[model samples]
Target chain A: MNLYRAHVLICGGAGCLSSGCKAVLDKFNTELKAHNLQDEINVVETGCIGTCDLGPVMVVYPEGIFYQKVAPEDVTEIIEEHLIKGRYVTRLLYERPASGEQIPFYNEINFFRKQQRIALRNVGLINPEVIEEYIAQDGYLALGKVLSTYTPEQVIQVLKDSGLRGRGGAGFPTGLKWEFTKNAPGDQKYVICNADEGDPGAFMDRSVLEGDPHSVIEAMTIAGYAVGANQGYIYVRAEYPLAVQRLEDAIKKAHEFGMLGENIFGTGFSFDLEIRVGAGAFVCGEETALLASIEGKRGEPRPKPPFPASQGLWGKPTLINNVETFANIPVIINRGADWFKQIGTEKSKGTKVFALAGKVNNTGLVEVPMGTTLREVIFELGGGIPNHKRFKAAQTGGPSGGCLTEKDLDQPMDYESLVAAGSMMGSGGLIVMDEDNCMVDVARFFLEFTQDESCGKCTPCRVGTKRMLEILTKITQGKGEEKDLELLEELATSIKATALCGLGQSAPNPVLSTIRNFRDEYLAHIREKRCPAKVCRALLQYSISSELCKGCGLCARNCPENAISGEPKKPYTIDQEKCIKCGNCLDKCPFNAITLK
Target chain B: MAKANCPLPTSNLSEILDKYKQSPGSLLEILREAQAINGYLSREVLQLIAEELGIPESKVYGVATFYSLFKTTPTGQYIIRICESAPCHIRGAQDVLATIEKTLGIKPGETTPDGKFSLEFTSCLGLCGVAPAMMINDQVFGNLTGDRVREIINSF
Candidate 1:
């Protein structure tokens, strides 16, 4: 047990790694030792610091001073002026995107202030790789308490009181789900953590695993005790090597501390954990499909009737929960259900972590309470659309979720509200879109993903999505007809109804919601072959403006297709027939005469 | 789970097979390990895994083809997986992809003549914060533009 005067926590999440936080971390270590403040000042590499857009982020505590985009060179300055001399490095402090006001502390910053971090409490605060740090932050205390104090039924009762729903998207009541598994007649049951976060824009689960792996391990251990299961598996995606490595390390550390494995906390309870790496299958996110994949079979979904609670892996009851869902378990146990229930709405309790990205000014992992409006999450916390672009829509739930429009801005982001507004609370990957994004393309983009990831075991998903994709492709290529829109709607309806798994059923959500909200965009593509946002390359035709064109001939020389020709000191003209719509001329044009429509 | 002995079991195919020997559901893990060792799962490797696991040859082959990660055909040393999911699509993934193709002189799904790079599109790398991102083998490159992608390919 050691106490430091100040701890400098650097974000070591994947987002920060991409931004080269490793270099910044090494510099802090080297510089701190150089200044002989290594022992007094603790430099810790923690997981994601939430504000992912501004990576290489760090927070120094006891003061909790926040720094963003802290480079290697900036480390020496910070150690000299801030840590040693005790002066705030104003230059490295987080400046408000609009006001240019520097907020020195993390809690005062709009992004951190607005966020309700329950699942993400220790993410940026503690070193995930270190078990001692996790224990120091009260990480695995719940496991010890649950094992020693509460009965299995009593544990389930606590979850029911908390009203924690499945954060994996379907919003099934967590308590009831656990009770079902417990009640299911089986002694050799299993507890599984669904870390197979398949959503494209979503990385919150990965961040959690990278940031606070012990939390999930503790939660799963608690789940095993409640469910009377001795073994657990965390199915992580192969794409996230960092998460897998962290979880593996954390699991081993848990074993070393007697938090996991036989007779945990000297209670008659015993549990073991394993990591099952998913081989790039999006469909495996489905519980049944995930089980099958873990069983060393093709990661395809089977029709659900024997819902995992009763008949799961090897005909035994299995309590399967997502990484986020599991992350909440240890917290709910430590804080008590009454404390947890007070935080969120009646139906959806606690906060949801969202990987907010795309056209939003501030793209990061945001965790807001259940009733937080999309407007606050987008405008207030996200810093509005980037480059002052008019906010068009914000996409949630990835391919399975739908696009939410301006009308849904004030709508509370809960299970029911989001579903009523044409989107479901998916794994919470909120992607913001501006006026420049074409709604038709957005729909097509999501559709294409679902279509590609379709497991082909089911017919409707296999063939139907392909047909819808064909029509969408035709529309994008300026080859759509009036009947195609109706056909798309027809296909979307049937696929939603007939598709076997949740993937196929919710596959058309993006398409249907886009059509419902932006029918005009679809109509424009179908009727006039015009892309309102000029995103469809085939529908775009670039022309030189006579007034603006200085006859620079840059467009002519740069056009790979040799489509532009003009005389010196005269307006240029593009030969429409010869133009390939590559937009090469547009990029190279110095006069800014070219405009696409 | 035999996971402790060899975390990935990349070097020896027989060791992976023996580890999860005759297990009910260990095909995916074995295939992944075999692929890691051999670069891509060859026909002989698939058959060997099937016989070792007591699963039918066809079933082993089916599992291999089902997963997008398990490559049946050979690929270049550097498998550049550019994300084609909605998040990257909105963030100029197409432009970044085109730049890679032009620089490498190879289209998507085609290997470079010298066996240095094989370009392909994957569903999502889950790093949408840095959209228009790609994963070259294990290392991730994000916030890509034409110039950045070109520079990356040239350096590779």
Candidate 2:
């Protein structure tokens, strides 16, 4: 084995890959060879280091210098100044926006300082494509320990003591679920990893799979042992091709190393795993719907009580846990359950990884303790909202979650506290909205998604959600009557109570939460026939300010419908009848004269 | 009926079917790989897959139609999937989408005249941190601007 003097870790996660990390990695290869340091220096392509806003990011080991926004051209400077001369690159280091201080080390940076990485511990540190690096980092140690020393009942006890709940939105107790599947009378019980993360703005599961695929594999094997199962299936999304590729590679490597397949570590325990790609259905995130899809049927949710633990996967008992939930298992066993229980809140133990995005300065994946406040996540860790915009609300849990306003900023972001604030932690998709955002429009946007993705399996979810969306759409279109608000409340309540599944039950959350938190915005849309945030196109009236209009004819020429009319050097008038409200004229105007009232 | 030319060789299709013969639940994988081989899932190809897997033709067709990833109609040489999720919507996704539409001379669900490009809106490609992102085939492009879109399509 060869050891490198210095290692340059390039982020190869989907987020960084989209931002040209591939180009940056290629440049580093060429430059390191050009400097004749190729043999001595190592460039390892790893998974997401979480700070996506600073990509293409790289952290050079030995010094642990954290570099941000690196380009292909800057490769030469990094190799020559940092690697060759033994001096850190001052310009490339991540500078704190608040203090303007250049922090070279990753742990020193505020964005990473507060983060407690258990699921993402090996993500940016080891090469995922190589299983040896993962093994060196004590990757399969927990599985070996579990199979060698502990019984199935003992393993379940550890999970129960740890208080680990499902991170896949519902927060079900994982150990209790495992115990049920074990006790359930079945000759062919199975274990499943739920990687079908359909929450629109969330990519936490994707990152875990891409970065540390072995952790999930090990966890699943442990789960297989605990549940008295020989077969495990990972139901992943087809949209996440990178993650799928990595998981496939990891499974193959584990098989080769005897960690997978029939007998492992000279023990009689035998487990095999296979990957099943989901076909673009949001409802498949639900365990029963996912099982139906695996059985080659349409992804639709069914009634519970005969839950997955009792009867699942071709009417056999199955243990199903979310990707993040399984990712925590190996760590819980290796470190012991008491350590895991001490980290998070009373009921919701351990950290939750959030796909932090929208209107914030630092947009990336964040893993904070379950009890971390919304204010710390948004202001301190996220660096506040971008463009100096005032915070309006933070929309958590996607369509299933409600909006958290300023009053809830101090609330701890655990499962119970978030639900108490009128929102549930639905897979940790924290979308921060600013003052410029329209509350009614946000509700309408989420409603549109839920409405489109509704499986039509039940009446309340199918028809009731449609009715609620119709009302929300009308309000956004400036055609809402005063009575619409009361009607929306009535419809939302009934749907929440009568819906068959979680999707239908939580479908009214965004609507109900917006009305509860920002009733003034809805009143403005309905009563005043105005969108105070200027987002609803139907409420916006475009006109040229006479004093500021240069009459350049740019707007007239650019309009697809030719809706702007004027003479040269004279103010133009918008033909609102002909205008399609496409906002083309506003984009074309050079003088910035057009105003939407 | 319109399957005059074969997208993949007959031997490759048989091999793929044989690999998944034991696992009946691999319908999603079979459809995904078949779509990748062919530009879209034509009825003729679906029938062939159904016969190979020993499942009914109607069941195969139903599975194909259930997924958003499997296209029933032929796509352009280049497929551009623009994300229109809430995160992207908040961060100028509309403007970038409008720019793509204007540049390509097509709407969200239409193909170009020469079949060079097709524009479609996807739910989310999970690149929300870099909002206003699009996937051109398997390669994702993020933090989009009008110039970036122009450069990308022009290269293709």
Candidate 3:
């Protein structure tokens, strides 16, 4: 392939796709053809560029000119000005959030500058839809090496030496699990990919799978070679339609290339893969429960010890790993164990992929070396809190993780560090909370998720989480008692101890962590019947301030509950009992007269 | 104990296994084809697969159920799925369900009105952002308010 004069790379990930990246790609192609630069300029649709806030993002390679928030209208100017004249489009260049300096290079942005891409190395660089693009980049070379050269034991040893732990919440030794499956007494063993990502504001696995599916396929094949498994299943949620489609396509191409299937590389080792669409069951994330669901039963987790590695599926050994974990496998094999081990902290090696979302200026996927501080991830990489709002907390590990307050901002983000700081790295979902977020409401929101997703398989998870949710609910509603905080802590500990599965076991993390860090906020809610953020609706009363009220009647007319009851020109009084606290009246109040007390 | 029913001939099973051995992502297709030939994906079929592939029965069963499209249990004629995503909830899908109960008088996860439809609530139908979506035998209906639900049911 001849090197083109210029390579125009467009972000093809979900965020950019939703923002019409495909249209941008099409326009680029059309404009190139129109300008007679089709042969000179190559338009390539790549994976996520990570600056999702300014998408659909595009980059001109060789020169590395980064363009932000490009639309269909801006395509002509880009082609005419930059492509024709070799001049950069200053308007399209990303302006630094704080400094307002136009950044030309993609790597110069704070978001990319702080990130250490290991698992997400291939994303935004390769066209995920093409198989050869992946293979050319040494995609399945690790699996090839493992299959032909190393034994299963050697592969496991390499993984162990790499210090690669599970990125899927528990941070258990990935090699140890593979070793267990290898040693387990089973004529049949399986490799399962846990892509049923249920965490809110988390899409790291989905992004990886969508961006570089061959990495996962290669890793799984290597896993199959290591664990003596012939078949692999990817239990992806049906919601990730694009990721699923790409995976399916990749698997087909892999078979066509003789990379997968019987006698792969003529070594007499056979492995086949299949995509299994999950019906959005959060409990199916648990390996045992995932196995049961794959067996055509209700998705519910069973007890461990006879772990999935020992007696999984229909009663055979099964090895399950998340997409991000699998994405890291090939790199570990190719780069060598010591190379990976050198990247992160002594305990946690390599990089972690986080879905940076919620009140952050740069809301996208970020991969950083394990021991990177939360402050760096938030203020530096994430471009600080949105709207100049003061950062209150950052919620990690989704519903199963905890809230980290401003004081804990300097804490290093790793398996041990997060756990020591009263939070576990639960699937690398980092939701930044600004001053606008209510601590009690935040706890309640997570509790609501856990409560709904609870499989009802265990007493503690089912009943205890519900009870905790009730306490959180009561506190948010200003009906909480002074003893409710004590009750919450007690119930949280009990739930953590007594829950059968990991789902239940970590269910109380949000509550426990929030209460530990934001105890004063809870006290204010219970004691003073006040929400410091004024977010809790029940504790707030919407009153039309006499001075600000021009009696526009917007509030009274838009009031769904008909709570506001005064003449048009006079100051309105909201009937507290009639107000359902929906905030419609307050939203519709044009004069800003409606004040929440 | 009664002898376990063997669903497929050993020779046919071996051939099927050999055909898919070199095929990547042939697991689901093979299982579906095997089930079509044998009425269901039986333990005997799975065991034969294990023996041929040098894997275990538990692993086979695990792969089968992980994908929602693959059914281990035999289903009735039609699958009536209800959308239970956020938008559907906001549009009073619960009340629409209650009406379904009153009309057919059957709860979700049950076959009703002469076993023609098996009602099961599913996640967002992609139309969500647009409320109250439900699928009946692969046909999707969206923007269903509570009152319009009965009309939909009657049409089905």
Candidate 4:
């Protein structure tokens, strides 16, 4: 390969692609050709560069100049000034949101500084569409080594020594799950990759699949070797089209390269994988439900302990792992168990990927070491809460997780630590909430999600979560009695205890965690009939401030309800009865005349 | 590469089993190909696959229904998947959903009377920032407003 003078790698992940990274890359290529520097300068499209909010991000390697929010038009200047003249585009460089300092290197940004990428190790570094790129980066090496070198027992033993647990919510030991399937009495066994991530604010699984499809393929192959399974299925949601497309492409290339089909790498271990598209069901994230879906049944949960490992798909022992968990297998195999063990805390060894979203400044995918504090992820890496809003709470683990307030900011991010902080490491979805967010509304939101996603197989999850949501809705609307809160707790506990699958078991977490940490907010909503955050629509009353309302008809004209009855150029009085409280008038009012009481 | 052509809706279970008896893990592949031809995995297909693979129909049915991707019923002309995933939910997807329901006058997971649209809620469409998003047919519309949703629906 001829060495180019420079490589301009642009982020081609979903975030940047939507933000016009493809146009930016095309323009860069055109400009490079026009400038006759095509031979010298090469433009490449890589996976996610993590700082998704500041996309169409580009990194000029060798110099490693980090550019944010680049447009197609900016490509000319970049080629003219940076590429041709060898002068840095200072204006295009990423400026610190707080200090306004120029950030030169991509890693120097707070978003990337704290993250320790392991599952996302190859993301943003390689072209996901190509197999050789994945191969060159030690992609299928682990599967090759495991099939050729290690016995099924030895492979499981190595995984056990590595201390690798499932990153897919449950935190069960990956090695133990493999062992169960391996030891089970069955002539035919199966391996499955659970890519049907149903969590809100979670994209870690999708990112791994989109950025490194081969990793999952290799991991599943290794899993097949360990569990003595000849076949595997990847149950990915059909919503993830890009990830699905990339995975299909990767699998085809793998088969063509003789990596996936019979006698792989010249070994006798034969394994192959096929993609199973999920038809938009959240309950399918549960292992049993997932297996049921793969078997062409309605996506619903079943009782475990005849767990998937003992009698999974078609009554055959099956070992199932999520995308992120599979991404870690090759790394754990390449680097010895002890080396992988040293990165994280004692129990939670190895890094975890989080889809950092919500009120944070830099919203994207982040992978941090297990012991890293929540404060670091929020402040240093997340670039603090946006719009100078005071940090109120952070919701982790999606619907299955809980809320953590300021008091728990210092808590480490490992599976146990998050659980200890009234949250679980449920698929690593970290949604930051500012002071303006209503705790009551937040709880109701999660309850509604769980209620909608419940497979309706078990009574507790099917009925219990709905009752809890009803109480929450009543409370948010200022129609709740004091006993409703107590009833909520009682119902939550019952549902948690009686639920059949993990979905039902963890559904009460958000409600339980919110009540535990923000009990006062609930009391205010129930007793004072007031939403502290002023978010509850029914609790809010739109009032025209006599001091500020200049009788500007803007408020009256814009009101969808025609509640502002005051005459133009005179003092305005908002009729409380007719006010719908949509906030349109408040937003349109120039003098800040309208207030929500 | 020779495409293995099995009998359409195989009648005899034992004969089907004998044909694919040597191939390991032939159950899912044979069933999928069979379903692809038949539009839906019928009981006859299940029984045929089970007998050919020396397994029971109950076992085949169990595997067929284990995954969400497989469908036993026939689908409509266009599948309109509204992402009820977390990000979309936060962006007032519930409101968008209400608008869709009122406009189409059909709840989610239901096909319209004309069979033009089959509405369903998916987990995530991978377009979070453009929240409150949905995919009508195969085209994805992000940062959805009720009006935009209506426009997309009308177009379909």
Candidate 5:
């Protein structure tokens, strides 16, 4: 193989792709060819570099210089100055939001330096479309090791020792799940990779599939070997078209490489894999519901005493694991359980990938150890909340998650601790909130989601969520009564106990947790008829400050409801009765007169 | 590829139906592919899929309505899905949505008179890093402001 002096790794993950990384990629190639550096310098489109706020992000190899928001226009200066002339492009380097201090190296950047990538080891490093790149990164070696040497029981023992739990919400022991399926009485057992990631703020699974599809495939194939199963299926979300495509390509290529098809390593243990695309349903994230969807039915959850281990798809014993869970299997096989155990906390023995988004300055994917403090993840790694805003809260899990305030920042992020703090590690979506965000509105938004996505098969999840949403909605609308709070608490408690599945069981968490943390905000909305964050429109009343209003008639002309009226060079007053709260007058006013109280 | 009114050609639908006819538990995939050709799964198209798969029409329709991605009614050429999830909500998705609605002279679940655009609220497109995001067809646009929303709508 020919060696290249430089490697340009441009982020091609969903975040950067949406941010127009493709144009910059094309420009890099064009400039590289123009300068006759195409052969000498390789331009590789890698996965998410984890700083999504500075998207279209790139990292130059050998030097490790990290650049953000890279445009096609910036490619020339980079190629001409950095690649050819050996001088760094200072303007493109990542600058700290608070201090404006530039950090040039990728390893030195706070966002990535703090992360301990295990499942995500190959994500941003290898080209997912090519199998060679994955193989070079020790991809199929674990499968080769497991097939060549380790017995089925031995493989299961290694996984059990590794203490890797499922990353798909519930954090069940993966080894136990695999062992149960292996021990279950069935002639045709199946291993499933649940890629139906429905959590709203989380995209870690999608990133894993898109960036390193082979990792999931190789891991699933290893799982099939360990669990004594000959067939496997990956049920992925249809919304993730890129992930599905990459998985499809990876599976076909794995076949050609003799890593996936029948009689692997001449061991006579035949295994095959297929991909099932899910029609959009949030309930499908549940294992039972996901199994039903794969069987070409309406995705709905059933009670799980007769779990998938004994009775699963088509009355067969099936071992199902999440995409992130499967991605960890190969690593455990390659490096012994001891190496994996050294990284994380006692109970949660691995790094968790978080989709750090919302008000944070550095919004993207970050994988940190299990015991990392919320404060470290937010303030140090995430670059804190943007625009000098005080950190209000961080909504962990998803719609089912609770809000973590300043008090919870110092707490270690683990499965037990998060649940004790009124939250769960539900797929690792950490959405930060600041002063401008309303807790009541945030609760209301999640309720609207759970209510809409509820399968309606169960009365409690379907109906209970709707009622809870109604009360929350009433509170936001400034029509809430004092009795509404007691009613919301009672309903939330019952919904947690009586709901059919995980979706309904955790549906009321955001509301309950928010009320527990920010009851003052809720009380202000209900009793004072004011939104503390000025977020709820119904509670917000628009008024014009007489001192600031110049009376140019701009506010009057722009108001669709004709709410503002005044004469020239005089103070303008907004008619509250006529105002629809559309904020047209606020946007149109030249002077800073309009305010939403 | 007919507009909201006309019946779609069953020839392409039959090909999609026939390809997945033998695959067990492919009703959703078949319906999804059928919609790709017809734009929206018409009653006749649903009947065709049901008949081809030997499943009841009600079963096919049940599966179709169960998932949000399948559209029974005809949408405009472009389906603009604005994510209303909490992540996007805190990032000013409301304003971006309002701008789109005002620009198109329609609300969510409504299409333009010329069949150029249809607005809908999606839970999350997983583009939260660049919050206040929307997906038109498969392309995602993020970090959206009101002026950017207008510019995107006009471009479409």
Candidate 6:
């Protein structure tokens, strides 16, 4: 082994990869070699550090100095000044958005200060491709302890006592599910990791799989040992190519190190793993649909009474847990159940990872304790809404969740509390909205998504969601009536009651929750044919403000339809007949003359 | 001379099939690789895959058509996928989409006349923080603006 003076950890997560982190890494290599410090310094490409807005980020080890948005040109400075001279680069560090104070260390940043990293413990800290780094962090110790010391019953009991529930949305107890599969009459069984993360704004599972691939693999092997299974499958979406590559590499490395494959650790127990990449289907996130897709079928959900525990994945007893849920298992085994039980609320133990996006200052992945309030997440951790926009609403749970208004900001962000506030914590996609966002349009956007991705297997989900979307579409287009609102309510309630799976049953959540909270916005759209947020283009009538219009002919020249008729040095007029509501004239008007009524 | 004589390649097809021939869930994997080799999945290629995998042609075609990733029709040199989900939409994805459409003279789900780029709006690329994001082939572009869209397409 080689000892190094300092290690440079660059984030190679998907967000950073797109932001040109690869170029930065290459620059570091060249600069370090040029400085003749290549042998003394080590560079490691790690997974996401959760502060996605600050991409192409790097951290210098030993001092643990954090750097943000370091481009290729800045790598020379970082390598020469920080790496060689032993001085921190003040310009590159992440300054607090509000306070404007530069925080040098990763843990001191407000975004990471409140986070309790159970699943993401090794994400930014270790190189996922290197097994030795994982081993150094005590990876696979849980599996080693389980294989040598405890039986299947005792392992399941510890999980049960730890009160770990599924982070995949429904909050099912992980231990009870394992026990059911273990007790099921079967000589052959299987364990599966649900990495088919279909939520649009959510990337928790993708981050975990990309950053700490071995954590999930180690936990899956432990799950196999507990559930009396010898084979495991990780079903991941094909869109995440980087995640797939890391997982495949991790599995290969594990087998070479005697961590995976048959007769591991000389305990005479055998287990193996394989990867199944899913074709794009939102419904495949459902366990039944996922198993069906893996079996080379059309990826549709089957009715549950013969649950996955009883008859799953080829009609045999199988244990399935989300990627985040499985990532918690190894830690629970290493640290006692009592230790794991101490971190979170009474009902919801451990931390929940959320992909916070939209309008917020610090938009990224955050893992907070289950009972953390929405105010703390959005305001404190998230650095509040960007551009000083007043908070309008926060959309949680993707299409299956509702929007919470300002009043619900103080509500505890857990499974039960979120549900009580008219939104279920469906995979932790918390999208913040500002004052300029149209609530009705927000609801319509989610409805359109659910309606398009309905799978068409069940009647209520396929047809009923379509009906709700049609009503929402009409309202946004300024063609709505008062009776349409009542009709929408009726259809949403019926769809909720009659839909087949969780996808169908929660299809009306976004619509229902918007109506429950932002009913005034809906009424204004229907009654007055006005969009207060100026988002509904169809409802907007473009006109030139006579007071401010200079009639420079820019609007007329830019307009594809020749909507504006005007002369230079005089006020202009817009022809409603020719106006297309394309917002071209609005963007062209320099004096802020064009107004939409 | 021998390569020029053969219009289509069948060399990697056999190797890919041999690797995944035993697995029951190899149908999707085979279709993906076959599509990659040929750029798009043709009837002849599908037939060759079915014959190599020892499965019926109808079943192979069904699996290909079932997946959104598999392309039956020929695509352009570059596929530009813009995320139109709620997060991106709220962050002005429509403006970016309009700009791309105007710049390319092609709408979503249509290829340009030059066969250089095809524009399509997908659900979410999972890079919501840097909203109004797009992907050309496999490379994701985030925090996109109208000016950046034209520059990005010109580079491709």
Write down the worst ten-residue block by lDDT for model 5 chain A: A45-54
In candidate 1, stretches whose alpha carbon ends up further than 4 angstroms from where it belongs are B1-11
For model 3 the local lDDT of residue A403 reads 79
Candidate 1 structure quality by residue, lDDT tens digits, A1-597: 567899999999887787779999999888888888777889899998877778779999999999988889898889889888899999888888778788898899888899988899889888999999899888789988898889999999999999999999889999999999999997899999999998978888998999999999999999998888999999999999899999999999999999899888888789999999999889999999999999988888888889999999987999999999999988899999999999878788899998888998778898989989999999899888878789999888888998899999999889889999988889999988999999988988888889989999889999999999999999988899988888889999999999999999999889899998999999899888899998988899999999999988888888888888889989989999999999888888887888888
Tens-digit lDDT track for model 4 on A98-131? 7878888877887877778889988988888888
For candidate 3, write residues A282-377 as lDDT tens digits: 788888887876765567788888888889867889999998999999999999998999998879888998877667777788899998999999
lDDT of each: 0.88, 0.89, 0.80, 0.82, 0.89, 0.89
What's the TM-score of each model vs. the native? 0.97, 0.97, 0.82, 0.87, 0.98, 0.97
lDDT per residue as tens, model 2, A429-475? 99999989999999999988888888888999999989989999999
lDDT of 6 by residue, A102-220 (tens): 89998788898989999999998899999999999989999999999999999999999999999998999999999999999989899999998888899889899999999999999
DockQ of 1: 0.69
Of candidates 5 and 2, the better by TM-score = 5
Q: Can you rank all candidates by DockQ, best first?
A: 5, 2, 1, 6, 4, 3
Docking class of 4: incorrect
- State the DockQ of every prediction: 0.69, 0.73, 0.06, 0.21, 0.81, 0.65
Question: What lDDT does candidate 4 reach at residue A589?
Answer: 87
Q: Which residue pairs show collisions in model 5?
A: none
Pick out the ten consecutive residues of candidate 2 chain A with the lowest summed lDDT: A94-103
lDDT of 3: 0.80
Note the chain A TM-score of all models in turn.
0.98, 0.98, 0.97, 0.98, 0.99, 0.99
- By TM-score, the best candidate is 5
Tens digits of lDDT, candidate 6, B17-77: 8888888876778777767775678788889888877779898887787667777776677
lDDT measured at residue A242 in model 6 versus the true structure, 0 to 100: 85
| TM-score-best of 4 and 6 | 6
Q: Give the poorly placed runs of model 2, Cα more than 4 Å off.
A: A582-592, B1-9, B52-54
Clash pairs, model 3 backbone:
A187-B55, A188-B55, A188-B56, A276-B67, A277-B67, A294-B65, A294-B66, A314-B58, A315-B58
Clashing pairs in 1: A295-B25
Candidate 4 is scored at a TM of: 0.87
